[model samples]
Target: MDIQQQLINAGQYLKANQLAWGTSGNLSARLDDHHALITASGTYMANLKEDDFVTFNLQTGTYEGTRKASKETPFHTGIYRVRQDAKAILHSSPFYTTLFACSSETIISELFIETMYYLEDIAYVDYYHPGTQELGDAIAEKANEANIIMMKNHGVVVFDDSISEALMRIETLEMACRMILKAKECGIKLNLIPQEVVTSFLEDSKYKPRKKKGENFQR
Candidate 1:
């Protein structure tokens, strides 16, 4: 794939979807096992140009080109270090997803097949100052078993084998959060899928890509 165009397209999608507002998010893609193409710090995700990204050595922590890398570069590299399956990483602060992230909710219940399949394990990390080594360490540790991570009082971070898979997981979690809020507003009790059904889905090899060992918690 043309990685530069791919990163540009991902940025545009995040902007168009309002996943990153007020220059609050960042995106990156693996250029090779050793380096990544990342958005520059404070650049608007919606309006990006080829020069807006920088190539950074994930191993040495040095960057090439005149543009500076995003402050969250450490976390991006950290995730790539551990996850051989991760080809792309997106960090965005979406409205509904952040709501659950800041709340007491540790997990969104299994209410849909897509949520169960694409976002099977959602990990929550305690709030740390963004762009700091502390936060990067926390994210790297939690991401060991999570494709989607809820940053406490912050946003969500997702890394997947492909950008589409990562973005889809983000969308799935956002929709699930919206559904939970709507149900509460209506005073309607939720009808979650049974544990047996969820377990069956998890154990099935066909859907094994989504399943990760974790617990379920309601908002």
Candidate 2:
């Protein structure tokens, strides 16, 4: 499928999975080194049309389409500017992830195989009013350190080499967050996988062959 259709399908998937609702999230894909295809401002993720997207110039910070680009375009472009490997981004406030974002709790990625691979390098960005350059800058500073960035009192920004990978990351993060919260509520002490074991899994496991070099396991 085309990039536009991939994003449209992603939006519907996000909504159906409760990862996004109303017009609360934004999605984007790199069209080239200089431009991006991003959701238009105020468009519902679940009900997007082709025209609901704008072609944005990364260098000039201008856009063209039937509607204006998302107000959060700054950070979307900022991330693409810094991370050459990043081809897609998804920013949303899923219930459990947002609940964790609002708290001081730390996310433990050593809980399982998927968690170790996907949630291992989360970065937390302090709250900044949405759509501001300050907010964009804050997130960009940590973009290289992690694929999943938890924005305090706001939401998360996840990016990867493809839209599908980015979606998988956010879904994994939300699940990890839910597990942590549920464990705490039940007064259960979760067993963390040992650091040595985690390292071995990343290096020697069969799954290692499937991972792109320097992808997903970044510190």
Candidate 3:
């Protein structure tokens, strides 16, 4: 399937996975050198389809099949503006993350290896009005430095080079958030991975792709 169709499927999957509730999340992908296909404003994610996706000019943030576009369009625009590597962005207000936002908790990847891959730490950006330049600037300032950013009293924004990657980051962040909550609930300390393990894992991982190069290319 084409990217538009894949994007639409991801929209459905977002709702199916309970990552978004009601009218609260936005998604977009780089359509080309200059445009993206994004979800429209106020559309129920549960009922989304490819037709619900709108083509937008990245330079102008103009949506062709407008349903007013997402209220958080600037946030997505901000991501692309800052990170040339970011091809898609997934922004969602999740339950645990919202709770963390309420308590002003900074996200730390304590228990999960998945989150460690995407977010060494998920930074919290100060509150800004949705869809405004303030919101854009706040996220833009930190997005390049962190893959996952949780907005103050708002939601979580994950930036990546593909829709799949963004979605996976969101899921991993949510899992970390939930685990944090569960630990609080049970009155047990979160078991953080040892630094040595984390360092070893990352070091070994970095060389995997290149390890095949010596034999495969034979230059």
Candidate 4:
């Protein structure tokens, strides 16, 4: 599929899964080393059209076409600039994930197999005003260390070599957050998988192969 259609499909899928709502999020795919296609400002992810996206210059922080790029363009470009493996990025405020982002709670990635893989190396960026260069710079500083970055009091940003993998990571994050909140609410003590076990699974398990940079894990 074309990049535009891929992003549209991702948007619709996110809407169907309740990972995104209304015009509160943005999605982008790297078009090349120097340019990206990002959802236009104020466009609803659930109903994105081809015209709803703008071609943004990653190096110049400029855009082509008529529509304005999403206000969060700085971070999108920043991630691409820092991480050459990043092909697609998804930024959204899902209920559970956003709740966790806004709270003082910490997430335990060793909770399960999926969490160990997807939530591994999550980075936190202290609260910065959305759309500001400071926020973008903060995210970029930690972009090389993680695939998922949580913006305190704002939302989460996930990126991977393919849009599908990016969506998978965000979905796993939301599920983990929901489980954590529910367990806390019920006063249930959750047993975490040991770090050694997690490391073993990541390194030796046959269930999933290690992900190499620039490999597309699109489903």
Of candidates 4 and 3, the better by lDDT: 4
> Could you give candidate 3's per-residue lDDT for residues 1-219 as a string of tens digits?
788777777778888888888878888888777777788887777777766777778788777864667878887887776677778888888788778877855566646667566656466788888889899888887775677788888888887777887788888877778887887889988778887876676567672221111111222
Candidate 3, which ten residues in sequence have the lowest lDDT sum? 209-218
Instruction: Please list the C-alpha lDDT of all candidates, in the order they appear.
Output: 0.83, 0.91, 0.75, 0.91
lDDT, residue 55, model 4: 96
Which of the two candidates, 3 or 4, achieves a greater TM-score against the reference?
4
Model 3 TM:
0.88
Candidate 4, residues 144-168, lDDT tens digits: the string is 7788999998889999999999999
Give candidate 4's whole-model lDDT.
0.91
Candidate 3 — which residues are off by over 4 angstroms?
A: 206-219
Query: Which of 1 and 2 is ahead in lDDT?
Result: 2
TM-score of each: 0.91, 0.95, 0.88, 0.94
Tens digit of lDDT per residue, candidate 2, span 143-197?
8788889999999999999999999999999999999999999999999999999
User: 2 or 3: which has the higher lDDT?
Assistant: 2
